[model samples]
Target chain A: MKHNPYAALPATVENIIVETSNITTFTFRPEEPIPFKAGQFVELSIPGFGEAPFTPSSSPAVNDVMDITIMRVGAVTERIHALSKGDTVGIRGPLGQPYPLDKFKGKEILIVGGGVGLAPLRALFFALAEEMDHYKKIILRYGARSPGDIVYRNDVATAWGKPKVDLMLSVDKGDEGWKGNIGVVTTILEKNKLSINIQNSVAVVCGPPIMMKFATIKLLERGYAPENIYLSMEKNMSCGIGKCGHCRIGPYYACKDGPVFTYDRIKDEPRIWD
Target chain B: MAKQLKQGCTINGVIEFLTTGCRVYALSQTDSNYHLTSDEKWESDRHMLGPHRPVEPLKSILFPPRQGVGRLLEDAPHSSPKPAAVIGVKNCDLASLKIHDYVFRDTEPKDPYYIDLRNNTLIISCDCSRPCDVCFCTAVGDQPFPESGFDINISPLPNNQYVLESGSEKGKKALDSCSDLLEEASQDAMKARDTARKAVYKTVEEQAAVKGLDGNKNYQNAVTGSIESHLWERFAEDCVECGACNFVCCTCHCFLLADGRSATGTSERVKQWDSCLYKNFARVAGGANPRKYRAERLYNRFDKKFNFFKKVLNIYACDGCGRCIEACTGKIDIRDVLKEALDEA
Candidate 1:
C-alpha cells in the first residue's frame, strides 16, 4: 500500500559501532519501527546528503532498534562515517520484496556470504537462529579477504561454537594466528562433507559477483537445484522503488522486485558472472 | 468543445480561452526546434505547437529531472503545484508518458514528486499534422492524433475557430471558464475540424509506416535463442557506452537516489537518473562489476527492453518510441539491431 519510493522518514542515529577497519555498524531508532523480513534492506538517507540500500545486521526480532553495518566505499558512506551518535538520518523501506522465508521452512538452509555482503545475510542468520527448531540444518560458510575484513566475527564465532548452527569461517589469506580455514570459500564447500542435500535445501548466497557466480556453480555441482539456489543481488539502485530504472537487471528492479532472487530466475541474464 | 486555430490567430487568445486565469503551457520553437515552452514568448505565426518531438518532454515540467525525496527539506519544501493545462503534447510523447506513468504511477506508487506533478497537470494533446521520420506511434497501437488520457483535445480547422472536445472534468472546467469565446455549434465547423484531423492522421501514418513488432503478443521467447549471437559484440564495439541511449530513452527510467551533503550543514537525499550502460552501475561493495564488458551491458539493455519488461509488466519495454534511435551518438538503431538479432537467431 505504501508507494512513495524516496520517502525516507527521519531516524535518530543511536550510535556508530565499529565492525572492521572499513566497515562499521550504524544503529538507529526510527520514528516508528520498520519491521521487515530478515533478507530485506532499507534505503538509508542522510538528509541533505544521499541514500543507499543497507540490510540491518541486527536480528529482525529486535524491532525497537536496528543496526546497518556499512562499508565506507562511496560518498554517502563517507558522510555516514563522519556522523556522530546523536546525528539525525532518514530511512525508507524495508523495501524490495523480501526473501521467500516461508518456502525455506523445514529445509536444510545454507548461508554463504563474503566480506560486507554478509551484512544482509546476517539478518537471515539471526532470523533463522531465532526459530532454530523449524529448519533441519543451518550451515553458514562465511569468508573475507582477510581476518580483519570479517564482520560480526565475535558474534558469528560465538554462534559457531553453539550446537544449533554449523558455522565455518574462512579467509582468502590468513595470518599465523588465523589457524582457521585458509582458501576460497568454495573450496571449503567442496572439501567439507556435510549432510547438505540439494533436493530439500535452499542455498542463499551473497558476496562479490565473481564469488557468487563460482559459488553458485559449486552449489549446483553439489546437487543444488538451480531454483533452490537463492542469490541476494547488489546492483546500482537509486530509488529503492521501481521508479528509478537504474537497478533494473532485465525487467526486474533490484530495488522493488528484488535484491533477492533464485538462481533459475536470473541465470539467463548476461554477464551475471562478473 | 475543441476547435482548430487559424494561421494568423494570436496564441494569447487560445490561452485565454483554454485558461480563465488558470496556468497553461504551450509548445514554442526555440533555436529551430519545438520545445514545451510557455506563453512568455510566442512571436512567430509560422510555428503552431512548434513542429513535433520537442527537445524535452512535457513530462519534464510535470516531473522535473531532479527533486528531493524521503523527508522534505525546509528550504526546498516540496509543493505539488496546481494542475495546469499542458497544451500541444504530441501523440508520441503522450504514449511514452503512458509508459512512465505505468512505472512511476501504477498500482504501486513510486516517488510522491511524480504523483504530485501528475495530479496537478491537465494534459491537452494535439494531433501532429507533421510527424517526423522516426515517429512510430502508429506501429505501437497509437496514432499521431490524440487518443484517450487527455483532459481536452483540439483539432485545427480552416476557419478561425478551433474544434475543442472535452475528455475529462478539467476540460469541461476550462471550457466553462472560457464561455465568452464560444459560439453556437454549427455542422460546417464540425465537418471542417474532422476533415483537418483526418488529414493530419493520414500524413502521420504515412510517415511512421515502419515494420514494428506485434503489439498483442510477447516476443521475449523469440529473443532467447539470440543471446549467443555475435550481433551483441558487433553492437557493443560501436557503443562508446556514453549512456546517451539510456538517458534519452523514454522507458529507461534507471535512477540513483543520492544523499547530498550541502556546505550549509544540511543533508539531503536526491534521486537522480542512472544508467546500466555505465561501468560501475552494478558494482557492489567489494568493487566487482557484474556487467564488466560492453557486450554484456548491451545485451542487458536490449534484454530489459525485449525480454524483461514483457516478463513482468506484460508489455514490451519498447513502445516503438524512437527517441533512443535518434539520441544515440553511435547511430545505433535499436530496431535494426533487434531485427538482426531475431533474423540471425
Candidate 2:
C-alpha cells in the first residue's frame, strides 16, 4: 500500500521541561524513530486539535526520542502547551533541509539566537559539540526578554563550557541579582568579547523577525559575508511540504527549499523581516 | 491511430459516451458563469466548445475544495474516490493543470490523493474558437488551443459540429467506441477549424496590443521592481476580502489543514482551499503577521503568479483566462493591474 503522506506516526510524551512562562519543551517517543539532522522541522499534532510545524529541539544522534520546544501562542500550541507526560500526540517529519555542517568544517562558527528561537539552535549546538575538534572554536550569543526567560539555562551555560567555546548570553532586561550582560543580545555582539576571525567565520542566526533583522545587520557590519550568514526562517507552513504555498518567501518555499537559508540568497527578496 | 474523425458528433454523443463507466461533469453555461453539471443532457443550442475557461477552476474538481485527508486518532479514514471524466475544459484550464501536476506530482512525496484522481481521470479538452473580452491568453505567450495534456481535443466548427482529435490512446478508443455517431471530418470543416483558431488569436492579440499588455510579458521583472510601489495600495482601495480571485484562479494552490469532527463523531484532518488575500493567510503563531496590510496581501497574490512561479518553474502561473476579472466584486482588472504595475516607476 502506498503510504499516506499526511498520516503522522503516533507519539507519547515522555518528559516535559518548562523553559519559561510561555515556552515549554516536550520530549516525545514515537512509534518509529524520527531521525533528523539539526535545523530541520516537524509537524507536531495533538489528537483532534490540529497540527503545527516545529523544529525538533533534540539532537539527531538521539535515536529513540525527539524533543520539541513550543510556546503557547496559537490554538494548536495552546493545546500542545497543555499536554503533559504520557499524553499521546502525532509527529510527521524530519522535513526541510538541515544546516550544512559540511560547509562550516574549518571555519569559526558564530551561533546567535533570540527568544524561543534558541530551540532549533539548541539542536544545532548539540550536533556541533559532538564534533568540537573539527572546527576552530564556537561563539554562541543568545538573548531573551528577561533573565527568567532564558531557555536551557543550565545547559547553555555549562554544556559547551570548555576552552574553545565562548558562551555569551544577555537579556533585554535584567532582574536584581543579574550579573551577566544586561542589554539585548546584539549588545554582546557589539562588545566583541570573543576573538572571531571574521573572514574565516560563518554566523548562524535564529530568533524573532526583529532580532534576526538587527542581528543580520550587526553580522554584516562586523565584516561577515552575506553568504556566510545563515538564518532559520519561519512562516505559516501548513503542509510541511512544498505542495502548500503558505510559507513562500520569494521563489523558495520556507517548508521545502528551507526553514534555513543564507542572508545573501534572500536579501533582495521583499519583506525579509516581516 | 489516424485522425478517426467524428465529423458531426454532437456534444451530447460525447457526453453520452463518457458517462458510460464513470461519472461525467460537463460545463453548463449559466447566465454569466460556466459550471460543471452532471445533468442527463447539456445545453444543445449553445456552442459546445468553451470560448474561454470557466470561472470555477479545474483544481476544484481534481483536488476538491475540502476533503478529509486522514484521521486524527484512528487509522487513515478516507480513501480516494472512483474516477470521473470532465468535459468543456479549455486550453487555459489545461495550462493550470500543468502547474498542479508540477506541485502535486513532480514535487517530492507525491500527493497520493491528487495522483489517484488525476491518473484515473481522462481529460477531454476543447479549443477556444473565440476570445472572451477578459481573455488575454495570447498576450501571455499561451495559445487558445490545447497543444498537449489532454486525452482528446474537440475543435469546434460552425453549426454545433466538432472535429474530434484524440491526444491519447484512451481518446482513440473513446472515439472508436462512439463510431456510429461520427463521420470523417470534411476538408471544409478542417479548414474552418484553423480559421477560427487564428481569428480568436488575432482578436486577443489586438486587445493585448491596444492595452500595451503584449510587450510587457516580462512580469517577473515588473513585480519584483515595484515591491514598494504605491500601485498596490491603490488597487486594494475598494477590496473587500472575499478571496473570489483565488477561488476562480486556475493555478492558486494554497491550502490550510484543520482538524474537524465528522458526522460519525470521528475526528479527521481536512485539507481545504486557502487564500493568501485573507488577513490570516501568512500569519504565524505569536501574532507576528507578515502581510498585515491589505496592500501586502494583494501584492503577494501578484508576486506569486508573476514572479515567484516564474523564477522557480520558468513560467508565469497566470494563464490569462481572466476569470479573476469577472469574479472580483471589487472590479479589479488583473490585466490593468499588470500593465500599470509594469509601467510604474
Candidate 3:
C-alpha cells in the first residue's frame, strides 16, 4: 500500500472563527507552514466528512497561521460551520499558481472583486500594502449581491482611510441605510477615474463567471491589455494539484497553472467564462 | 526437466517457469476476443502478446485508480508480496512508462508504492507480430517491439529459438538465475531478432496511414474547442460513462481518497482509482457541476490527453495503445474521433 502524503498530515483542526453570516474562516497552522504565493488555494477537509479547495484569506507572508475563508454554500462549508475554535480537520496544500505581484512593480494596480472572490484578492492586497512605497497606486472596487455579502468590509475601510489605497464598495440591491453606490461592480469601475495605461497598469478581477466576463471586457475597453487583466477562475477543483483532471481549462490546470490567469492566455479556450 | 524450444521460449516452458511461485498474468483467448487473467483453467493457446493496441493501456496495474493523493491515511496492511512477471508488453506502453517514471520517481520523492512495484516487477516484453487498424506507434516514432523500459525483451527467432536480451539489471539477474535454460547466442540468432522486429515495424507503418498526424501540434486546438463542438455528442452519444476506458488506460492516473475505519477501530485513509467518465467526477457537493452536460464531460477526456497532460508532463497522454476502443461497449473508436476532430478543423 502506498503511503499517501496528504493523509499523513495532521488532520487536526485549529479553530473555526465565524467571520460573517455566509462565511466561516478556518484558522489552522500546518506542522510546516506552506510557503505559497498569494492567490493559491489549499484543499481543506473535515476527515470522514468532505473536502473543498479555498484560497487563504490571510496574507501569504504570514506562513505560520493561515486563514481560509469559505462560503456556506456546500457540504464541506456546512461541516466547517459546525466546528468551533480548536476542532481538528485536515488541510493539504497551498497549491496552485499565485498572483503575479512581481509584474505589478512600479505600476498602478486595480483590484476588481465581487462577493467571496475578495478572499484571494485580500492576500494580494496586504502583500502590496507591506510595500506601499514601491507601488504607484492601488485601487480596489468591490461589490456583492448585497452589502451583507461583502467581506473584509472593515478591512477595506481601514485600507481606504490609510490614504494610500482608494477603495469603493457597491451592492446590487441597496438596503435603506445604504449610502454608497447601488450598482454592479462594473458600474463602480465606470464611475471611477481609472487610468488604464497599456504599459504600466494591471487589473486583477475575480467574481462569478458572468461578472468576470463583463468586468474583463470592461477593463479591456478601458485600455487594459488582454495580458494585463488577471482573472481568478473558480472551477470545481478536487485536488488543487495538476494530477486531478478537474479544474482544467484547456492547456492549463486552474489549480496548478492558475486559479489566476491573464485573459490572453486562456481567451481561446471554450466555455471559460462559464 | 521440461523441454525448452526457443524462437521466443517455448510457450509451455515459459509458463512452467512463470508458475513456480510468481503471479503470472497473460492473454487467454476465449471464444472471440482475448482477456487477461491468471486463471489457469481459462488460459488458452493465445500468447501473452497484445494484438490490438487498445486505448485502454496498462497504467492501472501499478498506479491505483482513484486513491488518496496528497492526504496521508493511516497505514493499511501492505498487500502480500507476490513476485510477478507480465509478458508481451508493447512499445507505446513502454514509452508511457517513462513518463510515469518521471512523474512518480521525482528526485524530491513521490508515490512510494508505485516506485516499489515498478522497481520490483520483472517486465517481459515481446515483438508485435501483427498491427491493429488503429495502431500508430511508428507514426509516433515508436517501434513495435520493446526497445526500452523493459526487464527481459524477447524477439521471436527462427529454428524455434527466442532471442533473449537483458534490458535491465533485473533482466540480467533473472537471466543469470535461469542459466540452465540460457545459452550463448550466435550471430544468426541476433539477425533473426532484427528480421522479426523489422517485419513488425513495417506492418505498423502501413497501419498508420494518416500521414503527418503523428506529432500533433493541433492537440491544443482539439482540446480547446472540443467542449463547444457537436463532436462530443456524436462520439460519446452512446457512451454510458462506464469508466472502462479509464481503468485500462496506461496513463490515466487520477484517483480519489477515502477514509475507512480499520478492524482495529483506527481510521485510515485509502487511495483508490477514479475515472473522469463518472457522472459525479466533476460534481461539487452543492450539485453545481461546471461540466454538467455530457459534451463537457466527454470533452475533458481529450483535453486531459492533449492539453493538460502535454503541458505538465511533456508527453501525449494517449500512448497509441488502443485499449479504450477494445473495452468500449459503445464501440466508439478514439482514432476516428481524433481524426474527425482534426479534419473538421
lDDT for each residue of candidate 1 in A1-274, tens digit (9 for 90 to 100): 1345556667889988788998999899988898988878888876765678887878889987899999999877888988898888877778887778899899889999988889888898888888878898888898899998889878887855556578788999999789888888897787453557768889999987778988999998898889999898888667676776666666577777788889887787665655
Between 1 and 3, whose lDDT is larger? 1
lDDT of 3 by residue, A1-274 (tens): 5544455345445766655688776777776677777888888777666677888888878888787888888777888878777677777776778787788899888999988888888888888888888888888889889877778767876755455577888899999888989988899888354544446888999877888999998888888889999999877776565654666777776877888999999998767876
Summarize candidate 3's per-residue lDDT along B15-125 as a digit string, tens digits.
456445656655655564555555332133645555533233556556655443333333445553466666666677777786677656662236666777676556776
Q: Per-residue lDDT tens digits of candidate 1, residues B274-326?
A: 77788887776456676788887888787777676667766665655577777
Give the C-alpha miss distance for residue B152 in model 2, angstroms. Answer: 0.4
The prediction achieving the highest TM-score against the true structure is: 2
CAPRI-style class, candidate 3: acceptable
Among these predictions, the greatest lDDT belongs to 2
Better of 2 and 3 by lDDT: 2
- Output the number of the DockQ-best candidate: 2
What are the models' TM-scores?
0.87, 0.95, 0.86
* Model 2 / residue B86 / CA error / Å: 0.8
TM-score quality measure for candidate 3: 0.86
Query: TM-score ranking from best to worst?
Result: 2, 1, 3
